[model samples]
Target: MFTKILIANRGEIACRVARTARRLGIKTVAVYSTADAKAEHVKACDEAYWIGEAPAAESYLHGDKILAIAKLSGAQAIHPGYGFLSENAGFAESCKAAGVVFIGPPTQAIIAMGLKSESKRLMTEAKVPLVPGYHGADQAIDLLREQSQTIGYPQLIKASAGGGGKGMRVVKSFDEFDAALASAKREAISSFGNDAVLIERYLQKPRHVELQVFADTLGNVVHVFERDCSVQRRHQKVIEEAPAPQMTPELRHAMGQAAINAAKAIGYVGAGTVEFLLDQSGEFFFMEMNTRLQVEHPVTEMISGQDLVEWQLRVANGEPLPLTQEQLKINGHAFEARVYAETPERDFLPSTGRVSTLIAPETNDFVRIDTGIRQGDEVSMFYDPMIAKLIVWGQDRTQALQRLQEALSKYYIGGLNTNLEFLGNLARSADFAAGDVHTGFIEQHMAELFPEPSTPPDEVFAAALWCELDHTQARASKAQRQTLDPCSPWAIADAWRMNQASIDPFEFQVGEALYSIQGMQRNGTYYLKLATGEKPLSGERIQGDEWQIVLGQKTLRIKIIQSGNTWLVFWNNKVWHLNLHDPVHEADDQGVHGGGLTAPMAGTVLDVMVKVGDQVKAGDALMVMVAMKMEHTIAAPKEGIVQEIYFQVGDQVKDGDTLLSLE
Candidate 1:
């Protein structure tokens, strides 16, 4: 085994690699950008090296800087985690040239699978089942259109070198073909520096099941079962599991053999994923092969009792295969839910801010949390917004789902909006629990998952009333203590008949809806009764200034503060700027609907597709902004003429900053 290896990545994957390296008695080195100078991954390594600035191109993507750091740190090998330079064939070749082992597949294998068009051709020769599509070298517009018609409508246009939903489009008709191809190519050029695309049949009800294949230097390749990554949004996986639910032994046997054949066809070594799109009719087609460790590899590790990273290290050291295909067996069902910092209700947009408070659930025999951050860690716009991955193992899928749901509820992130509720709902969905899932699961149930807020108006009222009562009594109790007697009449009591006038009436909005709340001091605690419900509420006092109240089975924890006439109740992960003004003092501050297009979050403008005075439709792309490595298109809000363009190509924009005007 190598004595030391440098992890050429950052965030949770870096930390994950260091953990596995420590188990193998190998010292680990970590490389970080300036933004991750004090990051958890840096702290977890034996030594840390500063690479470059915060942006990925200046830091994580700089292969030379990383190679220099590895050489200087006396690292014998380099482990490129999933993102950044992991699949860059040039980087792998450079490592070989420098006499430093790259703990992954050979450069030739990477290049073979890196380009989709070339890989499809290779798969065809290998006899691996492939979807019918166009991978020819002709880039002529009319020629591509002809191929699309040949392939059939409702086809997929994907970047030949794309991953993560970038440079991908699904066209349902021939009329939308030309525009989709252009847009996909533009995105492809920006994301992967390749405008070449391929057309393939788009299955309506498909499950993404990928086989985890590992091979040693001696040409011994074996399949480590499979993971069902069918739960996806925008073609990106959200939930994954190993030992796919309801998967038959015969199906597994055939798929495993096909995966081994695919890996061996490219002379693959180390850890790689052979992704297959399984149709509802029990037929599967080869999608593509990922030439590195995958993000959801943990679930496979838990079920197979294998450390894939250690396998990568051993394979890189030119070790022979330790196990054959017959040796591996699935132990149990495992699930991995990717916990992200985004709002599910607002179209799942990425959220950025400081994570003021992070309360992860207590771990047990069945639960594991792979995290790269802690409380006070800033979740900036500089990287991926994945907070952590919550993995759970059980004897079966039901038990695994139960453990996962419990863990999610206990997780508390204070500063930013997250999809905890969405995950929780998915865990309990009947269709999901029964394993009747597909790529369109979220799209089909979006309305049910993000229904209009069912939180009652009265619950908001009760929360406000309870908050005010707690504030009033605490203040009066303090004043009474300063008086001469220890047990004065004003001393805090649990149940004392209190005057209604002594307490305050509260009102707040939980969105666009309003509620009325009033509370009275009863005993030493505050009792609030909302107008919508007959049940009264009692607050659970915590610390000196905060109170937690349970209303309608959901807990509302708030920090109380007074700001002039309004009482700010920090609830629903936001500051509720309640209007406490009298009827005469209140002024309407209704929101206006018109404005120039605003950047949803901080990101770089990849393209300004339109300019000043350009005619636009309601959903026409004004520009594409790439933030946190995700592309978001700013579109026109209404059919109008473009009045102004405030940004240009390659401009870094902040959230809420206007990019253009449509009038």
Candidate 2:
């Protein structure tokens, strides 16, 4: 085993690997960028070294700097955790050339499986069943168009060099093929630095099942069962569960063997995932194999009772497989929900902000949270928006799913948008509970899954107290915790007496609506005066972020996170953003989206389609902005003439900054 290893990655995976290395008595060296100087992963390891600037190209993707850092840290091996340089065959070769062990598959295996087109050709010779599509390197637009017709409609155009939905597109008909092709290529280049694409039959309702296969340098390979990642959005997985809900023993054997065969064909070593598209009729076709640990590997770990990271270290150290395929057994069902810092309402567009408050359900035998995010950490536009992965296990699927829902309820995030409520709704949904899941699970049941965007009064009431209460006086050290009265009228149980009592109305903005709430002490009782009407209410902070809200006779625990002027209220499993409404700032920003076209989030303008005094119709593409690997098209909201253009192509714009003007 390596006495010390350098983790050539960042975020949760780096922290995750560090944890396993620590448990195994192996010291870890963390490589970080400028943005991650104070990151959680930096503190998770014994030592941390700065590589370069924040952009991945400047830091994480620079293999030379990473190797130098490894040498400086005296790391015997380098673990490229999942992303970044994990699948880079050149990096693996470089590590070998530097006389440093790469804790991944051999360079030859990586070269064979790195590109989708080449990997599919190799899999074909291995007799692995594949979906019929165009896997050739002919990048001619006309040729690709002709190939799409040959493959038939409902085809998928995927980036050959990468995955993660960045360079993938679904074409429903001929008319949609060209635009999708161009868009997919653009995203592919932006994400993977490769515009090479391959066409495949898009299995519209197929279940995304993948097997966890481990191979040792000594040529021993074993399958660790399967995981169902059918629940997805925008071609990316959302929720994953192990021991697919309706998988039969016969089918499991077939897929497991197929996955093993695929790995063996590439002389694959260490941990790799073999993915497949399982049709409704039980027929499965091979998708591309991931040459690194998957984001959803926790589900496999939970059911199989194996530490995959440790397995990776052992295999990289030339140890044989820990157990035979026959010895490996599934213990229980497990589900993993990838909680992200994104807005489900806004088409799941990645949201960037400071994570002011983050609290997960207490981990026990049944629940696990793998995360590197800390309170006050900035969720920037430099990388993936995933906040954490929540995993739960139980003897059966039902118990595990129940635990998942319960755990989601306790998971809370503040000061930014998150999919916490969306994941909870998914866990509690009837269709998901009944095991009727597929790639279109989210879109198929959108209405029931997504509640109205408007914040309800209960949450607004929570925000009222969030801004009204002062938390500094409430927080007590452990030594003084016992002395503080839990039921004090000023702290927990009844309405707090205002230090400076007055009838001033508190102005709050919930979503787009503004409310003026007045606190009135009438007839020795308290009543809240709102724009809608008046209500008798009282509240106090019961614990950290949790407040006891009293509405007439009923009492409820509402989670509130206050950061500066922004307040994130978590009530009834949903989070509502509340800010003290400033009419002055509102008037200033009216032209942001009203008169002048504005950037939705911080990004560079990729295209500018219009100029001053140009005529455009409603819904016409005006500009394109790409940020955090996500592309957004700014369209004309109404038929108008372009009055002014504020930004040009390749110019950076902040959130809500005006881009162009229309009249």
Candidate 3:
């Protein structure tokens, strides 16, 4: 075993690797950009080194700097965790040249699988089932057009160099192929420094399943079953589960064997994932092979009872495989939900702010949370918005789903909006519960999932009301303490008093209607209760100036403050900044325009289409913005004349910064 290792990454993955290294008594060094100086990973490791600026290209992607740091720190090996330079064959070879071990597959294996076009050819030779499409390198527009025609319409255009939905497009018709092709090429060049593309058949209803394969230097390989990642949005996985709900013994064997063949064909070593697209007809096609650890590897870890990071370290040290393929057995169902700093209500646009308050779920038997942030931490605009990954395991899929829902309910985060509620909705969705999932699941249910003015359950509303009252009373008591003043003459001594009856009732609108509640002064505190007929439905607990409330399955610690004449209630990763002008009679304003082209998420602008006076249609591509390796085309909201452009190519933008405007 190596005595020291350097982690060439940051955020949660770096911290995660450090944890395993510590367990094995290996000292770890962390390499970080300026933006991550105080990041969790830096503090988690034994020592740290500054690399470069905040942008990945300036820091994490600077392989020369990373290698120098490794040599200086006396690190015997370097673990490239998942992103940045993880799959770069050149970086791996360079490490070997410097006499530093790379804790991943050999450079030859990475080179073989790094490019999609080349990798598909090798897989075909290995006899793995591949989707029927175009994988040729002839990038001539005319040649690509001819190839698309042969491959059939409704095909997918994918980047040859990288994955993660960047530089990928689905062209449903021949008329749209050219434009889609051009847009995809631009994004590909910007993101991966390669504009090469390949066309593939787009399965309209496909489930994404991937096999986890590990190999050691001695040619020993084993399959760790599969993970179903069909629940996705915009080609990015949202939820993943291991031991696919409906997988049969025969089908598992077939896919597992195919995955092993794919690995052996490349002489692969360490941890890699073989991804496949399973059609509705139960046939699976090899999509691509990720040459690094996957983001959702936790699900596989739960069911297989294996630590993949540790396996990577052992393989790098020339150790033989510990177990054979037959020794691996699937244990139970595990589900992982990615909690992001985005608002599902606002079309899942990335939201950023300091996490004002946070409380994770209490530890339980079947629940696990992997996170690297805390209260007052800023969800910066520099990188991915994934706050944490929440994982839960149970004996079956239904039980696992139930546990996930409960875990989400108990999770509390405040300051910015999150997708917790959206995740909960999906967990309880009938189609999802029935194991009917595909890549297009979110698009099919988009309307139902993103309805305007969504309302929480009535019980949830009652709890919010009770929490508001307790917050108000706490403020009053705090003010009294600061002044050392006597109690108000109007204060009630014990029970509800008539003198306090004159206090105005609080009213708020949830969804389409209005509701009212009143607080009763008792026991040196004010209590607000929702009465259903003669029975009280809920209450709040307030001691000193802190408040906590339980509503249905969710518990929240909230603060209520007055802004002008309106009241704002902050809880659970969001601030309900209500402009409380009227408790009833508000308009359902649909077309009221919000000014400017604010970035839907934080990202670097890849290209700007307009030049301050270009005529465009309602849905024309205004610009392409790249965030977390995914490219999203910012479109025009309406047909109009361009007034100004606030950004250009290569500029980093925040979530709500105006990119362009219309006159």
Give me the candidate number with maximum lDDT: 2
Q: How many residue pairs in model 2 have overlapping backbones?
A: 0
lDDT of 1: 0.82
Off by over 4 Å in 2: 453-509, 514-571, 575-595, 609-615, 640-643
Name every residue pair that clashes in candidate 3.
413-573, 414-573
Residues 1-663, candidate 3: write the lDDT tens digits.
Answer: 999999998878888899999999999999888888888889999999999998789999999999999999999999999878999999999999999999989898898888899999999999999999999888999999999999997899999998887788999999999999998898788778899999999888899999999999998988899999999875778999998878888988899999999999999999999999988888999999999999999999888888888888888999987778888778889999998888777656677778876766665668988777877788776677888989999998889988887777666576888887688778878899999888999888876666566443444444455655545567666665666344665442223445654233567654455556554444444444454421233455465324565544546565544444434444443334443336355566433255367787778888787888898899999898877655778888888888889898989887767888887
Quality of model 3 by C-alpha lDDT: 0.81
TM-scores, all candidates, are: 0.89, 0.88, 0.89
Error of 2 at 47 (Å): 1.5
- Residue 408: error of model 3 in Å? 1.1
Error of 2 at 586 (Å): 6.1
> What's the residue-level lDDT of 504 in candidate 2?
43
Superposed Cα deviation of residue 14, candidate 1 (Å): 0.3
lDDT minimum window of 10 residues, candidate 2:
471-480
Runs in model 1 with CA error above 4 Å? 456-504, 522-527, 532-594
Alpha carbon lDDT at 623, candidate 1? 91
